[model samples]
Target: MSTTTDTAPITIHIPTPLRAYTDEQATATVEAATVGAALRALVDHYPELDANLYTDDGTLRSFVNIYRGDEDIRHLDGPDTALEAGDELSIVPSIAGG
Candidate 1:
């Protein structure tokens, strides 16, 4: 048996606070078949953020949220959702005690 998969290349906008973990780059481009895959690519590219972005259970952190353009993934399908080319994503870490 053989299987084939199609993946898209999308760009993720890294917020200011997370730039330090990404070598000061404001954005990064990754190729994957789904939102979850894209995030893993980001983690691979910036290993410093492994703990901050994901938990040991392979789930996104509670304080971290992902956006597909202006739409929140939590309301969509979490990370298992698929993304397309030219899609924009933002990693916004929830702030507290403001």
Candidate 2:
């Protein structure tokens, strides 16, 4: 991929529960080459969100699921999933209910 493509802006949808960490913004725009990079940028921009999204081992928390459009990243390339310009990644948290 070209430098321009790697630097393309990717929008990540922040779920309602995590909104408080992002100043209440529903979405965050970042320039990254992969889903992981975009996520890191978001956490870097909002340091407080790290503990909520990642485990102490530096891996994504199991309860958090990220999707690109209708497909989950795990079904794609996981966090290494390549991102293109205008790509939108949504963070979906798992909810357990009886």
Candidate 3:
């Protein structure tokens, strides 16, 4: 695999519930040219998380959301959006009840 030496690595904060899928790490660094690539990098590193993030159509799961620096992904070309250094990507799982 090639390394990203020129661009700063982006950080993806792993929520408590998803920590187990990432070997208990609270945060992980992923190297990618774009947000979609970063997500692919994440799943590559943690195969178990693939099911939680993607649907059969290869779209992000409806119950899951990806935020880029407080911006919702759906409004920013979804995962294909590019990401810069210091940008935050969060994966939020929807809660159910009532």
Q: Pick the candidate with the highest TM-score.
A: 2
lDDT agreement of model 2 with the native: 0.91
Candidate 2: segments with Cα more than 4 A from true spot: 1-5
Off by over 4 Å in 1: 1-4
Q: Against the unseen true structure, what C-alpha lDDT does each candidate score?
A: 0.87, 0.91, 0.81
Ranking by lDDT: 2, 1, 3
Better-scoring candidate (TM-score), 1 or 3:
1
Report the number of backbone clashes for model 2.
0
User: Model 2, range 1-98, lDDT digits (tens) per residue?
Assistant: 27625566999999898899999999999999989899999999999999999999999998899999889999999988988889999999988878
TM-score rank, highest first? 2, 1, 3
Candidate 1 lDDT score relative to the true structure: 0.87
Clashing pairs in 3: none
Quote the positional error of residue 15 for candidate 1 in Å: 1.4
